[model samples]
Target: MKKNLFFALLLTFGAFATSFAQAVNDTVYVTINRLPVKVNPIASRDSVYAGQSVNLTVTNCIGTVNWNNGLTGGSVTINPTTTRYYVAQCTSSAGCVGAKDSVRVVFKSLISPIATSASICFNESTTLTAPSTCTGGTITWSNNSTGGSITVSPTSTTTYTYTCTYTGSGTSNASGNLTVQVKPRPLAPTLVANPASILTGASSTITASNCSGTISWTKPDGTPITTGVSGSSLTITPTATTTYLAYCTTNGCSGPSASQEITVDSPIPSVAFSAPQICQGDPITITASGCSGTYVWSSGQTTPAITVTTTLSNYTVNVLCRTTAGDSAPKKIKFKLN
Candidate 1:
């Protein structure tokens, strides 16, 4: 019985020791090493004009950077003449691996600019247009205007030049020119009227000078005087004051006109009798006034005043005023004899 108890105690102690060691050894402490972070490079700008430069940099990379194009640095400058893509990688000093990063850059180019031509009269306005769109450049006209189109009014024939200044990666200028043709205009003509003043029914002549081309006469309202006006001189019989102007035309262009006026005058006489009644042997005198031209009487007298003796109970005399152009209405006086 004593030997059996000793063996059983020994068995229980071994089991307990085994269980304690297993519970303690089950918990473990270890040191871990993590993989390095990859680097991704970013570009400062995604697009640039031709001949312009851009920068590509790796932000998280604390060490040397390598590009697919064999460039090594934290940042690299890219000058692309055309659209292209770029890639770069970086590694940190702490064994961090860099991620592959790529960016696409677009380049802008310039095209030659062109200008259109036109024909216009002097001092007339017209427009010029550039049909092509400007890329990476600005279009400027010789008149110092900026745009695709511009309007100008020039006095004489002119040559217009347009320039395109490249503001992109390229630094240069493209130029083209066109001419605007202008037609010449004649100078104003001078007009003169011969015998500027005349009596009624008298004809006067008008002449033109300093005319560049065919002369045309018109009234103040621009209506042509007479049909088919073709000469420089015109003979007119005007009853009152009248005005006429002459203009010259050539090559579908006309110049200013000169105007001239001719004056016409008419005269009428006034008469009075010296006595209203006269005896058979008595004499009577008549006087005329208010006329600077010649006077004629019904009794065949051509003087300003006349005297007549008549035996009839009643008598009548009439006088008329005459000018170089024509005669005026008659004036009459009556006399009675006893």
Candidate 2:
């Protein structure tokens, strides 16, 4: 009985000591390492034109900083030709990495600007187009237009200007101007003709006014004059009574000017007469042919043939041909008596 009690006490003491040691070891302590905070990058301009430069900056950055471009810096200047994103990663002195922060840069431009001058005729329309290369902008015209292209018609000369506006971050605008010249259409030409009445095969002077470019003349028969097609003055001869028309042409515009009528008279007639020379104290006879009207000789004879019984010096005779058209100019015949 004494030995069993001793062994039991020893077993209880060992179990209590083991339990206490386990209890003391149950309490735990932990240490934690956290990454540093990331700083967002800032740029001088979020949007920039092509071939332009921008400045980027980062704040609250600690110890070794790594950028996407393999460069370490607090501030940098970048020239971006397109949309780009830039990131910066910073680390603390305790050798902990932080989350990366980034920024975006957009590229744009207004290039190849064109505003050409224009010329148009009166009551005509012309189209105006702004430069098509400009991006991210609204085109506005001086005439209160909001389109890239527009057509305008002006009675007189006019001037126009176009403006391009870009709205948003890094907003920008540009402008260009052009002039449009409007020319008035020429008026009808005035025509004038000399010698209202002309003899057959005779030419008349023709003149025009308020005419420009090419001038042309046409007969009443609608036949155009091929020669002397230019200038404001010309001469033409017609075999019979004819009317003429004048026209002016300029810049693909042509119209009749005025019309003139010229009267052509019939030609004079010719006569053939025979007079025989006689000696003193001899009777002389004269005959006329192709005579269509009454005739009178120098001896007061009203016949086609006249005889002079007594001629001392000279005698004169005249014959005239007349018809409904008109009277001939006149023909004279003289006979010499010896």
What's model 1's overall lDDT? 0.74
Per-residue lDDT of 55-95 in model 1, one digit per residue for the tens? 78877766778787778887887777878778766666655
Give the least accurate 10-residue stretch of model 1, judged by summed lDDT.
Answer: 108-117
Task: Give the per-residue lDDT of model 2 (tens digit) for 32-95.
Answer: 7778778878988777765556777888777667779777788887777678798988887788
Alpha-carbon error at 148 in model 2, in Å? 2.5
Q: Estimate each model's TM-score.
A: 0.47, 0.42
Off by over 4 Å in 2: 1-117, 168-172, 184-188, 196-202, 210-226, 237-338
Output the lDDT of residue 211, model 1.
71
RMSD of each: 12.2, 13.2
**Highest TM-score model number:** 1
